[model samples]
Target: MGVWLVLAGLNGAMAIGFAAWGSHGVEGEAARWVGLGSQFQLLHAVALLALARFCAKRRRLFRPAAGLMVVGVALFSGSLYLKALGISLPIPMVTPLGGISLMASWLLLALAGWLACDHARV
Candidate 1:
């Protein structure tokens, strides 16, 4: 619970910081990277907050979803941030992997919701 909350807060702050940089401190390709990264990061940050709340009631089901979200953000947004700063990782597939992870997280979240609802009806 605490971990999720902390991660949410941190991601929110980082997203804002990157957005600010994108808007005022950079231009061209760098700005694009920051813009995209910050947008996804902020969206997921808010989602994580909601997930944290849900975890209080369905910790078993939602925990994996939250974990995957974290990883997705770190990899996807982290790679974009690096690209913005003109740093490229040797691994070219990291950004795609991150996107896939994010998609998986959402799927897991849906599954968790289905399972939780099923259990509730039982």
Candidate 2:
């Protein structure tokens, strides 16, 4: 939980900083990528906070969800950031992998909520 909070804070701060940079310093397609990355980072940072709350009750599901989110943000947003900086990597599949991870994280979160609801009914 503590680690999540810290990560959330750092991600949020980076998002804000990147957003500012994108608006002022970046342009064209690079700006678009930076903006997209910043948006994802900010959203996932907030998601991390929500996941922390959910984890208190459903540690099993939420913990893995959090982990997936972290990995997703790292790969997806990280790749976009690097691209924005005009850096290309030899690994072309990284962005797609990150997208899949992000989708999986959302599915896990939904499953966690469903399981919690089912447990409450019992």
Candidate 3:
């Protein structure tokens, strides 16, 4: 929850930065990457918040789902940010990891819902 809030806050800042100072800063490959990445992060933030609400009563479910979300964000969004920023790093394989994390997150969410319902009857 706190993590989501922080990322969401960061996204808000980045979104504003891109909309404002990024005009000249974001250009070429890096620009497009940043722009798209920022949008993705923003959307992810919203989704994460919503998911948190849904997972409120299911802490066990929330744990894995939240973990996946964080991993996914770090991989998927994090990659794009670095790529866009033209950062000199070992061209990390962050995007794929993020994608896998996202898929796991979605699947876990479903599983969590089922588990929650099952436990209700137990």
What do the candidate models score in CA lDDT, each in turn? 0.92, 0.89, 0.70
For model 3, residues 44-63, the per-residue Cα lDDT tens digits are 66767777666555577776
Model 3's alpha-carbon lDDT is 0.70
**lDDT tens per residue, model 2, 1-122:** 78878888888999899999889988999999999999999999999988888776756988899889999999998999899999997998898899899999999989977876857557
> What's the lDDT for residue 94 in model 3?
68
Every candidate's CA RMSD: 2.1, 1.9, 3.6
lDDT: worst 10-residue window of model 1:
113-122
Best by lDDT: 1
TM-score of each: 0.92, 0.92, 0.72
After superposing candidate 3 on the true structure, give the runs of residues whose Cα lies further than 4 Å from its correct spot: 1-3, 15-24, 116-122
